[model samples]
Target: MAAAKGAGTKKPGRARRKNRPSPRERLLASATSLFTTEGIRVIGIDRILREADVAKASLYSLFGSKDALVIAYLEALDQCWRNDWQERVAELADPEEKILAFFSKAIEDEPEKDFRGSHFQNAASEYPRPETDSERGIIAAALTHRQWMHETMTALLTEKNGYPSESLASQLLIFLDGGLAGAKLTHDIAPLLTARDLAKQLLGAPPADYAI
Candidate 1:
């Protein structure tokens, strides 16, 4: 009997598994697409559920509410942005090269069409309440990214170029941020190139012979 039961248990080919998307994954995918195209506030729970082809109970079970889902979506976006930049910046061993790689990555990452400005900036602009966890998380991530850029620039300036001034890094950061803002506002690549030029000038480093 035990042998028979074991044989019956092993009778199937491969065990078939359901390929359906989990409730959370479906909701997140829906929110990501909607939020990327439409502004975050404009998208509501009903629309997300309908678009995801999920029931309200599933969404509520996954995210608790629309606001929570929005926060999760932004967090996911942050991770993706950071990962892309990190990969681009990783190719060059030199810190200066890496610094320039930052701007290069920015220009490269620009959308082909319907490119709106920074998602974090846009989201924060809509939600200014610092008390909210979502707003606070976005603000914190933005600051962290800026700090990473500044620190990377500082390391390059100090280690590669031997610049002694502590303030130089912060100044470079300001210039780079301005360049990025200009690029977004003007929708022109010139500002990014200008920023690269200015970065070389600020670091007292020579222009790179090759494009990043």
Candidate 2:
């Protein structure tokens, strides 16, 4: 009772792949975590690769260089912050309140410990006076975020809202950045609170106490 030769042979089993993020995603996530916690200029590609558990060749293939990866990380961060801002201001009825919500949300979201301030501002500070394409790209991404906030605030504070000055919106944007920088320096959200109060005064709205 001999079995058939071909029938008795067993087929080789295929390897099962784990459910994990793609190399690009892992690299971005690693870069974002390191860049925000540590300065972008200080964190190198090797660190990012080690954190991401990805290969050097994969990184080079996907991003072309460390600069490209930084740009991708900044772009991703910009989108995330924009989405958070939109969600924060979505439910408010007053355009002015929506603008104010940005400040309030910042206060609420900040943990007061290891706070790193705005990613765009950090990137801008690191890449000031860009000379190369990558440097310019980095700065452009940062400025894009700032420009968006300025435009959004301008629309919110336009003539329909009884405030017609785009300069005021620009001022508010500066205040937000200033407050964030102060918070980073002081390791407290008190500066942001001050910024919010000043913004209220500027908008001629009654000041509400914000406790962090």
Candidate 3:
């Protein structure tokens, strides 16, 4: 009887360990999904803990507070977006094609419901008063991501076709921004397709080459 009881307890313990997410990872994943779907302010620490299935003590131990979790979440999102784009771009041979690929992938991944705007933009709006270091860090990270897209597109335009790199880059960025905003506001993919058509015109290419 004693041996059976010990084995049962050990099994449950092992199962619990397997089921639990690491505190830091749990908080980050929870915050990312919540903040991306809902406004950051609307989702509080309690909700994060519940969604993460982590203890309040564990969250505090890992992140210290809600603000820290939010910063970490944004940082994680930044890394993820960068890595995904790099992977997608790597699949294409031409630099200009890669630029179009980036936009194409963005539209393909449009959310089905509760579609909030860009995570960076939403976070910036929520934490307008950046009195803390954490908020500043998130803002810097978000800006870096945006700047990277522009710089990358500019370099590709200059290197691939010798276009007016600065002007072309600005135009492309505006098109992309407009597409994302329109997609969220209108809940339609037509805007994305329109953006792709405009991009092809800007690049002087056939629709097949730049189809998103």
Candidate 4:
């Protein structure tokens, strides 16, 4: 009957519980938390496996190696960060809002999130070797994040104030990168606020008051 048929119709694929994440997701999730909270270099494969509740074989089979895992984490973070910023600012149609939203969220969210600042920056510092593929991947990921900022500023500046994207984008990139670095060093969000306010003025918006 219908009830019997329904009871027999168990969905396929590993029979995971409602709340449980898959092995791959578990590995990535565990690494993300650890790498974000603690720098990536100090953490090892055994710890990541233990935290993820997965086996070493699973880690090897799923991610190949520690370096790959780290690279995956950074690349994922970069894509997600950019997408999240876009979604956060989707409601505000102003190009300037799209531009400033990056700094505003960094100012507001970073502190509440323990304010480690840029994952790319952290990865670059952690993996300094240019020879290895995974290490080079770290550098590439960091550059990709910067490239996104550059292209974003370029488009916004072109649309809003009729300025050349190449020139203004470079300036904006400096403020953003420097602001993040200084904010991390000082444990203060004031530099980001200053950057945002300065950007507002440059973009022809009303100047914001930035007081720490």
Winning candidate number (lDDT): 2
Assess every candidate by TM-score: 0.73, 0.84, 0.82, 0.84
Instruction: Look at candidate 4 and give me any clashing residue pairs.
Output: none
lDDT of each: 0.71, 0.82, 0.77, 0.81
Better candidate number, 1 or 3, judged by TM-score: 3
For model 1, the run of ten residues with the poorest summed lDDT: 203-212
lDDT, candidate 2, 46-123, per-residue tens: 899999999999999999999898889888987887898888877877887888888987787666436688878888
Error of 1 at 62 (Å): 2.0
Q: Candidates sorted by lDDT, descending order?
A: 2, 4, 3, 1
Candidate 4 lowest-lDDT run of ten: 203-212
How many pairs collide in each candidate, listed in order? 0, 0, 0, 0
Flag the better candidate by TM-score, 1 or 2: 2
**Residue pairs of candidate 2 with colliding backbone atoms:** none
Q: Across residues 1-212, which tens digit of lDDT does each residue of candidate 1 receive?
A: 99888887842344532556777888889998898778888888899999899999988888777877877887787778678778877677777677777777766665542435566666667767677775576567556556666776777766765544346677766666666677778887677778878877766645342112
Residue-level lDDT tens digits of model 4 in 70-129 = 878878888888888988887988887888888887888778757677878888887666
Q: What is the C-alpha RMSD of each candidate to the true structure, in Å?
A: 6.2, 6.0, 4.7, 5.5
